[model samples]
Target: MNICVYCGSSLGKNEKIKEQAISLGELMCKRGHHLVYGGASRGIMGVLADSVMQNGGEVVGVIPKNLFKKEVAHKGITELITVDGMHQRKSIMADRADAFLALPGGFGTLEELFEIITWNQIGIISKPVVVYNLNGYFDSLIQMIDHAVDVGFIKPGNRKILRVAETLEDCMKFCEQEL
Candidate 1:
């Protein structure tokens, strides 16, 4: 299966997050899955791509033309696709992937995760969306979603659209089930 991964372009302060990213990539390879992600050669993105490539896994990178010109595209990926803008990049990634996973990241990662969940909610896509909530990174966000459900802003059933996994093993299990 082709798994779409949304993660940081900039690695945060924690080295463990980078380790986790690499582990996730290795897991994908062990499961015989291909990666479809934002084509960047920095932060967790680069680490994950490298791990997958090193493990002899196929990686498909979808990068925006602007970012590609900025010299952040992963040149060593199995396949690199350049799109005109962020929207097109996301669209193409989603279209090509059979499942989606989100690693801890800043605004960009959150945006991509939410967009995929929203797409599933509205029937634009039915693919599974899993969030790797490592070390409680997404605890507050999960709480906020629960609050939304309580206040009737979001339907209760829709809350299940975002599957939360605290470990790489759990994440892989979810992916396998989805596939």
Candidate 2:
């Protein structure tokens, strides 16, 4: 499986989030899954790519042209696909991946995850989307989602579209079983 991971380029203040990202990478590699993700060599991006490489798994990085010249691109990736802009980068990554997993991240990660989820809701892509709710990093977000259900802003059944895993092990298991 080629799994696309949407995560932050900057490691958040929480150390556990970074740990989970690394663990996920290693787990994916050990499971013989390839990784498709943003190609930054910093923060969670660096940890994920390095973990996969260390575990002898393939990693394909889709990076934008601006970031490439910004000199933060991971040179150790098995292959790096450079695009003209962020939208192109996201499209290529989504096209390359068979599934999507979102770890605790920032705005970029949220954007990527929301785009995939929205598309899934609208009958665009049928790929499975899961969120690694590391150390309950997404508790508030999940609460907000429930609020959306209560407020009628979103269909309550739409919550089924997202599978939240509290640990890397459980995340993989959920992906194997539910996705």
Candidate 3:
């Protein structure tokens, strides 16, 4: 399966979260799962790709041209796809992925996660959308989502589109689902 991961380009200072990236890569490699992610050679993104490659897993990186020009693209990845802009990059990522996973990240990661979740809600895609809520990184966001459902801003059934995985095992289980 091709699991599209959304994560920060800058590896944050959270040691546990950082290590989880490595574990995720190892798990994917062992499971023979392909990785589809933002092409960057830094931070959590770098660690994840490197771990997969080191463990003999295929990684397909979808990177924007601007970021590629900045020399942040992972040249060592199995394949690095160059795109014109964020929109194109996202469209291609969604097209190439069989599932979506959100790791700890910054604004861009959150945006990507939400967009994919929105796609599932709108029936644009029927794949499983899971968020790795490691270290409670996504606690507030999940709360807000529940609040939206509580206030009827989001239909209760729509809120069920997102699967919040609190551990690596949960994330992998979500990935293994046929959806």
Candidate 4:
């Protein structure tokens, strides 16, 4: 499976989250899955790309030209594709991926995952989206989503578009079975 992983370019407060991202990448490679992600040589993205490459898995990184310098795009990637802007990067990644997984990250990570889910919900795509809820990092966000559903902001069925897992194995299994 070609899995697109959305994560942060800056490491968060917790070291465990970063470790879990690395573990997830290693697990994906071992399972014979390719990784598709933003080509940054920092933070969770960096850890993930390195893990996949070390484990002999294909890593396709997509980055916007404007942020290439700022993000310090990963040159060690199996394949790095540069685009004009964020939209182009996201478009290419989504098109190439069979599924999407989000690791613990900041607002940027949240934005990326939310965009994909929105795209899926609006019929732009039909790929499976999973969030690796490392250490319950997304607890508050998940609560907000539930509140949205309760307030009739979104239908209950729309909630089914996202799957949350506490571990890499659980997330991968959900992707293989549900996606």
Listed per candidate, the RMSD to the true structure in angstroms reads: 1.2, 1.5, 1.0, 0.9
Can you write out model 4's per-residue Cα lDDT over 1-179, one digit (the tens) per residue?
Answer: 99999999988788887788778888998889999999999988998899899889999999999879898999998999999988999999999999999988778788999999999999999989999888888898899999999999989999989999888898898777663
Off by over 4 Å in 3: none
In model 4, how large is the Cα lDDT of residue 62? 97
The alpha-carbon lDDT assigned to residue 19 of candidate 2 equals: 81
Report the backbone clash tally of model 1.
0
TM-score of each model, paired residue for residue: 0.97, 0.94, 0.97, 0.97
Show where candidate 2 strays beyond 4 Å.
177-179
Top candidate when judged by lDDT against the true structure: 3
Give a tens-digit lDDT track for model 1, residues 1-179. Answer: 99899999888999999999889889999999989999898989989999999999999999988888664899999999998899999999999999899999989899999999999999999988999999899999999999999999999999988889988988877766642
**lDDT of model number 3:** 0.92
Candidate 4 pairs with clashing backbones: none
User: What TM-score does prediction 4 earn?
Assistant: 0.97
> Sort by lDDT, best first: what order?
3, 1, 4, 2
